[model samples]
Target: MNLIEHLKEDVRFEESLKACMNCGVCTAICPAAEFYDYDPRRICDLVQRGDEEEIEQVLRSDTIWYCGQCMSCKTRCPRGNVPGELISVLRKVSQELGLFRHSEKGRQQVLLMNSVHRNIMEIGYCVYPDRVDPDYHPEQGPIWRWYHEHIADIAPKLGANYHGAGPGALRDISEEDLQEVRKIFEVTGGTEFSEKVKKNS
Candidate 1:
């Protein structure tokens, strides 16, 4: 599809891309630009020019995935543009077109989808203590390991209901609520798209 056609598919993209005056403000304020070779200003420039080939290249490259989606660019842009939101639109387009598989970082979506998606679907929490294995996530630290081991003993002290019903952290999620979440996934096409991503990866 043409760049303009694609842009029209999502109104947010058109709204996100205000005329780039070649101002370096977006790149200057971009945290990803500092740490990585990612420059949202360059992306804006390319897309603003309606260069389909370059935009496709941007979609396939690691540059598009580097945005932290902090929307700091939105806050800093002189034209009221949102490079972070634009990056999000780019990411969705990349994933939908199966272009994300071209980058190593993008390929990691399989791992993220498997873990985070399943965590939300089954436990109703994206990052539950029981699911965080110390071997897999050493960054969680020794304290997390200790807490995981002594959760039963420590949870009561912290006023967390642990496995019981009702409010507070790690509380049991009802089957009814879980079914509702599943319904949302189904209605939003999230489940089908996620399955397609897994298969393509």
Candidate 2:
């Protein structure tokens, strides 16, 4: 299938790309462009021109993955284009095509999908503080490490339910609700995508 046609079917991508005048505003406002070899303007041009080879090249490269998805370009585009949304479309296409394995950072989606999705399915929280290993997530800082080590003791003091039933932070999630979450994941292909990412990565 033609890549542009496949991408155009996505509502986000369809709405995001109105036109590109090559004004360079999106690239100028992109934070990723400042730090990495990423340019939203370039992506816009490639997609606008329907350069399938270049678009596929971008999907397999670090360029598409460099987008922080902060939606800065969406807010700043002179033509009302959404470069961030366009990048997301590229990413999803790349993942579906197994092209994400071409980049170092892209390969880490395996770990991210495994950790975050597993947490969501099993615990009903996308991020459970206790499950975060300090060794792996050093950027979480020493304070988070201390919190992880002492959550049981500190949670009750902070008015958190901890493992107790019902609502509020760290409370026990019901099995029924957890099953519902798993069903949602199954229906939405979240589980399949996670497994695919893991296998490909």
Candidate 3:
């Protein structure tokens, strides 16, 4: 199938994009648009126009990755188009086709896979407190370094279980529960999708 035909196969493409009147409401409300050079209105126009070349270019560019998937555009769209959701579809297609590796932002999928996704499968939490090492995540800064050094002491004082027993913040998830999480990922194609991102990146 052609690129447009492949895009149409995704249910998100149908649900997110109806018609874009170019009113620019989506662009106006998009946080990513404010921060980055992204224009949700223009993206909608391009997808609506169904130019295969342009769509392929979008799949390969940082434009699709710029969307934070906040879905603010969905709330104010005059034509009821959800540009953020459309970006989701575009990102998935890009990963599937290995086109995401063409762009700098898209290549970060590997890091996401190794970090958040991997953590979810192993620990049953996307961002486990122990996993956020200050060395790897220097962006967390000196305060985080202090927190990391003292988390075992400070966590309990703040009412967190830390690495201890049943039920509460930062408590260890049971092995049975972790197995269930892995099963869910396997059944829902999350594992397959992560593998695709790894392969493509």
Which regions of candidate 2 deviate over 4 angstroms? none
Root-mean-square deviation per candidate: 1.4, 1.5, 1.5
Clash-forming residue pairs, model 1: none
Measured against the true structure, the TM-scores of the candidates, in listed sequence, are: 0.94, 0.93, 0.93
Top candidate when judged by lDDT against the true structure: 3
Task: Judge candidate 3 at residue 115 and give its lDDT.
Answer: 94
lDDT of 3: 0.90
Q: Where is model 2 poorest over a 10-residue stretch in terms of lDDT?
A: 1-10
- Superposition-based RMSD of candidate 3 using all C-alpha atoms, in angstroms: 1.5
lDDT scores of the candidates, listed in order: 0.86, 0.86, 0.90
Model 2 TM-score on a 0 to 1 scale: 0.93
**lDDT tens readout by residue for model 3, 1-201:** 388887887898998899889999998888999999999999999999999999999999999899998889999997777889999889888888899999999999999999999999888889976789999889999999999999998998999999877999999999999998899889988999999889777
State the lDDT of candidate 1 residue by residue for 1-201, as single tens digits.
Answer: 675576558769877887888787989988888999888988888888887898888888888889988888988899988888888788778887888999998898899899998888887888887888988889989998899999989999999999889888789899999999988999988898888888879
Q: Residue 106's C-alpha lDDT in candidate 3? A: 94
Q: Which structure is stronger by lDDT: 2 or 3?
A: 3
Following a full C-alpha superposition, what root-mean-square deviation does model 2 have from the true structure? 1.5
